[model samples]
Target: MTAKPMTAAGASRASVLFPAVAAFAIGFGLIFMSGLVQAETLHDAAHDVRHATGFPCH
Candidate 1:
């Protein structure tokens, strides 16, 4: 059996689709993990990020 070559349209659709699907999966995973993290832990991380970026988070 021989594998069929991908058409131009099929390749274009796949290129667009893969990123969208990956982004959605990453976003969903982050949201799910955020829910499981403690509030203080989250706040501390945010605060550290803010300070690291030179944004005063007083």
Candidate 2:
């Protein structure tokens, strides 16, 4: 048996992933580029996030 060629309908489904990947890249870039942030501020933010996510950081 021969494989079927790809059509726009199948290709369109793959396009849905681009926005989610872009959003993750943008958010991570913002966090990484904010270098002037104080250590205490970063620690507090991380601590808060850990608690919010129920992840043990200690």
Candidate 3:
């Protein structure tokens, strides 16, 4: 089967715009969801890391 050539508008819109839009949407969703997650501070990570390292951060 042969592929038909795309119209000028279709080609530009598909190649340039669709991927740019999809990437922007993915980045926006990631940033938006990150705001919903609880972030740990250095002090919070210290204990976990210490225990994992067999150091016992207490």
> What are the runs in model 3 whose C-alpha is more than 4 Å off?
1-14, 36-58
In model 3, the clashing pairs are none
lDDT of 1 at 28: 86
- Global local distance difference test of model 2: 0.62
Best-matching candidate per TM-score: 1
Q: What is the TM-score of each candidate against the true structure?
A: 0.39, 0.34, 0.38
| Poorest lDDT segment (10 consecutive residues) of candidate 1 | 31-40
Please give, for residues 1-58, the per-residue lDDT of candidate 3 as tens digits: 8977778666755587888999999998764443333345533645455556554344
lDDT of 2 by residue, 1-58 (tens): 8966768665555676897799999988766534324466665667766556555444
Higher-scoring candidate on TM-score, 1 or 2: 1
Q: State the lDDT of candidate 1 residue by residue for 1-58, as single tens digits.
A: 8966878656667588989999999998785444434467675666666557555454
Worst 10-residue lDDT window for candidate 3 reads 31-40
> Which residue segments of model 1 deviate by more than 4 Å?
1-11, 36-58
lDDT of each: 0.66, 0.62, 0.59
